[model samples]
Target: MNIRQDDPAAPHVSGLLAFHLEELRGVMGEHAFALDASGLSSPDVTFWTAWREDELAGFAALKHLGAGLGEVKSMRAAPSARGSGVGRALMDHVIAEARQRGYRELYLETGTAPLHEPAIGLYRRSGFVNCAAFADYQPSPHNQFMVLAL
Candidate 1:
């Protein structure tokens, strides 16, 4: 597997990331929480793309939220790449990258639905624990917040 930082605005990355956003919208309906294309390109955000051979496995991003904190955003494994370790690899990379950026902690918001269990398990295995909302996010029945001290 090859993982590298890339411009989320690039055609290929943008298209795949857009698919991820759309998938979230479908799953969460009016409560989808993904950042849009331009938001991914913000100065404080770092986007990463993963590939196995010539296949685009998936992508994830880290958003610096100031005060020694960072947020995990837009983590998605392509449908074909599910169960292939793409999500785990991408998550490990994000965690490491957040540490490298000097963040004291990393946080994320995911859904509480059964459809989100796999992701919750992923974060749990990665050392994240459930927490109250952070940044601009407000507490909501549809959202589950998690945090990892780095």
Candidate 2:
């Protein structure tokens, strides 16, 4: 798979971004934290798309949180790409980028719902450990926070 920094607003990414947001909202309702295209396009965020030849396989983003800190955001593998290592590849790419940017810690917030189990497992396997809420997030039963010290 080839991974490259990408624009969320590009035609190639719009459909997947819409689907990702819709699915997250369907699963978590108001508690969903996945960003929309506008959010991912913020100046502090760097987005990437994973491609298998001409097909878009997945996407993920890293948000600079200032002071050597970074947050993982908008990680989603296409339905057709799930279970084929796309998620792992995206996670690895984001982590490597965080390290390269001199971040001392990488953080992420995900849901506690069953729909999130696979992602939580992936995060754990990638070295993230449970942590208290960070940044602007409030502690809640619906939210699970994790961090990896770089």
Candidate 3:
């Protein structure tokens, strides 16, 4: 798989992005934290897409939160790409990029629903440990916060 920097507004990414947002909204309702295209396009966020030859496999983003801190955002593997290592590849790419940028830590917020177990497992396997809320997020039973010290 080839992972490269991407534009959230690119036509090729619209379908998966919409699916990702819709799924998150369905699962988390008002608490969904996944970014829409406009949000991902912010100056502090960097997005990337994983491709398998001609097909878009998955996407993830990293947000710079100042002071050597970074947050993982908008991570999703296409339905067709799930269980094929796409998520792992995208995650590895994000973590590597954060380290490259000199971040001392990486953080993320995800849902606590059963549907989120797979992702939570992935994060755990990647060295993230549960933590209290950071940044502007408030404490919520529906939210799980995690961090990895780089």
Candidate 4:
């Protein structure tokens, strides 16, 4: 598997993103949480994609929030890519990019669900711990917040 920075609008990036959202709807029973794929397509955001044998597996984006802070958006792997380290690979790439860019911290909002447990574990293992909400997101029973200090 290979993970690197890329344009979020690339055909593979878009497909992984849609696949991620569709899976979210299935797990959350609705489109409760959405990754702003459009924002990822912006030039202001730093995006990354993970590939395995040239197949699009997952992608992540860092939306610059100024003052060495960034929000991790649109980090997800296709269903077939889950549990195969694609998510971790993408996250590691994004987090490292954040630190390299001199960000003090990285934050994210994910779902709170039995199905989301694996993702929760992934974040924690990557040095993220529970944190208060950041950016425009507010406290909601459906969302879980975490941050990692670089």
> What TM-score, computed on C-alpha atoms, does each candidate reach?
0.94, 0.98, 0.98, 0.88
**Per-model RMSD to reference:** 1.2, 0.7, 0.6, 2.0
> Which tens-of-lDDT digit does each residue in 18-86 have in candidate 2?
999998889878888888888999999999999999999999999999999999999999989999999
In model 2, pairs of residues that clash are none
Model 1 misplacement above 4 A: none
Clashes of each: 0, 0, 0, 0
lDDT of 4 at 124: 97
In the range 44-67, model 4's lDDT, one tens digit per residue, is 688888778878877778889889
Name model 4 segments beyond 4 Å from true.
26-33
- Candidate 2 residues lying further than 4 Å off, grouped into runs, are none
Residues 24-104, model 3: lDDT tens digits = 899889889899999999999999999999999999999999999999999999999999999999899999999999999
| lDDT score at residue 26, model 3, on the 0-100 scale | 92
* Alpha-carbon lDDT, every model: 0.89, 0.95, 0.95, 0.81
- Residue range with the least summed lDDT across 10 consecutive positions in model 2: 27-36
What lDDT does model 2 reach? Answer: 0.95
Instruction: Evaluate model 1: give its TM-score.
Output: 0.94
Better of 2 and 4 by TM-score: 2
TM-score of candidate 4 versus the correct structure, residues matched by position: 0.88
